[model samples]
Target chain A: MRKVSSASKNADRVFRVATGVAASSPVVFLVVIALIVLVQAIPSMKFNGWHFIYGIQWNMGNLYGALEHKNGVTAAAGASYAALPFIVGTLASSIIAILIAIPISMFTALILAYRVRGVLQWILSILVELLAGIPSVVIGLWGIITLAPWVRDNLAVWLSHLGPVVPYLRGPVGTGLGLLSSGLVLAIMIVPIITATTRDLLMQVPILYREGGIGLGMTTWEVVRYICMPFIRDGFVGALALGWGRAMGETMAVLMVSGSAMNLLPHNLYSPISTMAAVIADQLDSALTDASQMAVHALAELALILMVLTLLTNFLARWLVTRTGRRRSTKAGVAA
Target chain B: MGKSISVTDLKAWYGDSLTLKGITMELDANRATAIIGPSGCGKSTFIRCLNRLHETSPGAKMEGSIRLEDEDLYTMDPVDVRRVVGMVFQKANPFPTMSIYDNIAIGLRLGGIRNRTELTDRVEKSLKMAALWDEVADRIHTPATALSGGQQQRLCIARALAVEPEVLLMDEPASALDPVSTLRVEELVEQLKESYTIVIVTHNMQQAARVADKTAFFLNGELIEFGETTGIFTNPVDKRTEDYITGRFG
Candidate 1:
């Protein structure tokens, strides 16, 4: 009979523990962050109930002259964060960013992933990665110094025409810190995330798919649009979700160029406003009243909401991936 | 030995390394021509070269002449050459993402048939010819991956046939399939030979013996013998061919 070894048992136990830790770490980290944000946000939500979310009047703290006390009511009483302006700012900037980024990023990613090769591919790939590596603050500063003035001076005539088409474009016409500025900055910030991931997805496609597509006599662009893109639509969506989340969470850059003005909504394309992040930066440190504190807490709640939205988007993309994965290499059924 | 596809001092290379050296043989059209050899003997490579699918790997180079009738396929466009000669792989590589119907339709669509009615007709005819129409007709709309191994091989055959190429190439088409599926594919090949010039590469001696009209024995990048299948199996003209068929060596 072979002797049982205690050493092997101990090694096996250690291996099991290590594997568990490796598997659970990411899941635990995500759950903990979500719980923390949600727990911190619960009190703010409890205070004003639905009224806090629906009410548009942001003048809670000083505007109402609410006094501080042992009571949490003063925090709820003072003029504080309203979802309306922050919601408008976020939607406006993100949409503008997507509009600008999607066309250019798609073209760039398509060129890099498919058409370009050799040294040019290497150089362009590096440049795109470098763009992603640049910090949000750097993008904001660039937008403020370079892009803002350039667009203001050169695009002034085009900017005026926007008002006639849309009610939101109604505003005093000067291109300083505004919706367009934050959006353009957001476009620059998100382009790399979208481009790099799109490139990776494109690369992961089997060479056979391209051959098969070409063998069928598809033109270069048609093959990409139909065969290549369709096969990796889920990945592109996943990249877009990441880009959108990054744009939503942006702080220093949007604040720098967003003008951080307390406004009801964008009356014009050049209308300056505060994003959720910008509001947090401006008000969190010196939240003088209880309502102001609640306002800060509300931004944290918004962060949780954004987290949930992106998580849901990721789930949708993952589902699509699995659906396609099932069919990649199956053979024909044997006839009975 | 089979249908005539004139080859003259043919050589193929991958980048700097030559894989097939000064090969010369005529492939008989309208008959199954089997090339049997060891794993790296370039039997599969030789068949793929026929279809021009060999150069799909970047830097794969072929020299000398591979004339399909009077026209040299190397001189003409490879895409046009590929369109003329269809290939089936070692593995039954059906596009799992596509439906059985769509899998058949894909090659036709690539061949530039825009009419849905024409695509549907061609898909049906090819499926029927491949002997897979009955089993798969009901589930034609279902994903190809949902099929059994034999069915997938037949589906691949149908996909190849859908384009209506002049010649068909198989690279161990039944190697991954079960015996029954292999037999079905072999039988399907016999039927396909009526219209298309058939070139097959098989490791299985019995499979080659059962189906091939001509057999070409290869070893270590060289063609040892090319003759009638009946003569090669029964009374091999070369000792190497005899040794290979008698189970003394691969």
Candidate 2:
């Protein structure tokens, strides 16, 4: 080995420290955000106690009303902040988006990875990625203008006919600016995310393994179904979880198409709803009008909740990807 | 039962370049035929063509008339052709996600043999045929990838055999193994020839001599000489065949 000069050694040390900081910046940022949100949410946490999550009411109260003191925190009289409706809305719409996205994304990923080739494959891949790059607010606008109307005039009406078969499919589809519209908009936003990630994962599957399936008399579809899909299972699930995080945290787009339903729960698939993210954006103005500042603290509490949820999902995705990656690497080691 | 294969004027191309230049030959049933050639000599491509695996590669194409016994190979569905002709690659490739039992059972299960007892028996028999039954018998539920490289190769062989193909194509199956494993695979090939028509592509001339009944020499994608292994190794009719067998040139 060549001996390193002291100058070069100092450079190496600096480089290592720099790279380490770059690598850990995300974790540092996450911790700082969590700490700040937790501190800001303390007042709201004391006032609401367990009711913050389970209570259905979410009111800023009249800002002109007399101030009331309770749980060592001051707020406008009759104020309440229950997040049950927003929690349900967030989960339902995101779950609906996931349900609608999985199959479509998988098939699209398959075509991108295996079916098409050359210029067509390149073009399709770029187009899919371009969809991901499009502004979410633009998608929200499209949802308001075109998707909401279609849902009201077509999808909701057609789905209502199946009301006798499925309980959630019942009539009273509303103005179409609700759960179904929010879910559809979210699905469109997440499909490109899931599809692009899945395509990359599918493409990483070794040709040798695929050839083993093909050589064993499996049809092309069978090869994909039995071999390719199973090989990429963990990575694919990680992609879905990543997309789930994005859907849950999405604000502007979901807010626009969500019909901004507040203080109530959706009774059916077509009923209006509001996610935690949408609620934060939609209620901030009125929340700021509360002179006691309790409303702002409550919004901070909501941010804390959203942060924790997204973090959990992101951690789940990382864990899944690492688990599969370690297994694949070990397998490769043995083979080599 | 093993089926004979006959080829006439087979030509293959990878994109615009021709790799196999109109070669023709016949392979007998229930015998191991060794295709000996250097790297890039189309030995592997020729076997890939038999199961239509060659066409699966991007820009790869072939022009050939190959008959599996009385059946035209090209006319049959590629999937059906692959069923009658299974291939083992130069590198071992057992499905990493599967257990040893599942690895062997996959081909059969997908082929619609869902009876549990039948699947178990076939898996056992295939493992035994590939000479991997004893080592892996107790640990059949373990991941197939946990096995050693040579065992994984045998596992792949067993995977192919479980499908009950009439012809087994080994593309340098033992090239990646140690001396001991190579000898074991050669012995397995000798044993397997009693039931299946085996076409083995190898760069090792001694391996061809040990396991093959008939040997074909491929150079620049042409069938230079083909005859009894003993005769080709000893008295080659073609000068190029003698040069290759005697280690004069690839």
Candidate 3:
């Protein structure tokens, strides 16, 4: 081995440090953001305790001694600020979106990756990419103007017939700006992401596997069903997790179409709901204007919960990927 | 139930480029026919066309006719045609997602063999035929990819065999293996020839000489010569064939 010169050794040290800093930057940023949210949420935590998360009510004037009567002065009525409604709404809509999005996106990805060819394939791929690029606000606007009324007139009426049998469908179907519409809009929004990722993963399956299946007299569909899907099962799960995270964080679109009601629990798919992000987006200005700083603190607490939710989702997805990856490697090792 | 294959004026193309041009040959039942050629000389392409695997490529097309026994292969469904004519690729690909047992059983399951005992028996039989059963019998539940490269190739052969195809096409199946593994595959091919018609494409002239009953030499996408293995190697029918066999030029 040759001895390194002092200048070259220093340069190598500097390069290593630089790369280390670059790699750790995102983690540092996340930590800083989490600390800020936690600091801001301290006041709310002191006032409401854990009820801020599990309590279902969302009145505005209930912050720390804000309504205490003193010196012959009548105090304003206190407001309740339970966050359960928003959490429920966020989870329900996201679940609905995933259920609707996965099958359509999977099939679209399959067709794009394997069946279609030539100029048509290129055009279809471009369209999917274009869908991903379109602004969420624009999609929200369209959902409000067009999709909402169409669902109200059509799906709501059909759903109403099942009202007596199913309690969830028993509520009056308002002009379709509610849980179902928001979920549908979310489905449309995330389809492109899921499809593009699934398509790329499917394409990554080696041509040899396809040849092996074809040689064995399996049809293209069977090949995809058995070989391609299983080979990339972990990837597909990761894609769905990504889509779920996106749906959970979605604000503007859900706010516009979900009717932004403070419903504790949705009675039907057509029932209006409010998500945490939507609540913060809808009331941050007013919360800041109020004399009591409790509302702002509550909003901060909500933001903290959302951040934690996002982190938990990512951790779960990572765990799943690593578990599957480990199993595959060990199996491969045994064979080798 | 090996079947004779007669290829008539078989021409293959990928887009506008010709890969195999008007190559005609007769492959007899229960015999091994080796196709030898230089790289890009369409040795692999020729065998791929026999099972319609060549046409699976984008813009790939084939003209002329291939008859498996009395049936015109082109007129038949490609899926059905592939069922009767199985292929093992140059590289071992034993469905990484499947276990050793499932890898062999998949072909049978696809062919609508639903009985569990029947599938297990066929998988064992095929594995035994490929001479891979004794090594893998204990870990048949393990992923097929866990096997060594040569074992994986044998597993792929067993997978194809499980389907009970009349003909098996192998493309340089031992080229990727060690010398000992190569010899094992060669011996296995010799035994397999007693039951199935085999067409193997190989770049190794020695491999062709060792296992092939009839040898076909291809050059520049055309058949240079094809004859009995001993005659093709011992005597020169064409200068190009002799040059290639003698290692004069690929």
Candidate with the greatest TM-score versus the true structure = 2
Off by over 4 Å in 2: A1-24, A313-329, A332-336
lDDT of 3 by residue, A171-194 (tens): 588879999999999999889999
The lDDT of model 3 is 0.88
Estimate, for each residue in B6-98, the C-alpha lDDT of model 1 and write its tens digit.
Answer: 778777887887788878999877988999998888887787677676776657888778888788888877677777777887766566467
Chain A TM-score values, per prediction: 0.82, 0.90, 0.86
Local lDDT at A26 for model 3: 100
Candidate with better TM-score, 1 vs 3: 3
lDDT of 2 by residue, A197-308 (tens): 9999999989999999999999989889888988888878888988899899999999999999988899889999999999999888988888999999999999888888
Show model 3 residue runs off by greater than 4 Å: A1-23, A62-77, A159-171, A317-326, A330-336
Q: Kindly list the interface RMSD, in angstroms, of each predicted candidate in the order they appear.
A: 4.8, 2.2, 3.4
User: Could you give candidate 1's per-residue lDDT for residues A53-102 as a string of tens digits?
Assistant: 55555654553565543235335434444566776787788878878888
* DockQ metric, candidate 3: 0.48
Q: List candidate 1 segments past 4 Å from native.
A: A1-57, A63-72, A75-80, A96-130, A153-177, A195-236, A267-273, A286-292, A311-336, B1-5, B75-77, B234-239
Instruction: Give the 10-residue window scoring lowest on summed lDDT in candidate 3 chain A.
Output: A68-77
lDDT of 2 by residue, B1-250 (tens): 8999999999999999899999899999999999998888999999999889999999999997999999999999999999999999999999877889999999999889999999999999999999999998999988888888889999999999999999999999998998888898999999999999999999999999999999999999999999999999988999989888888887
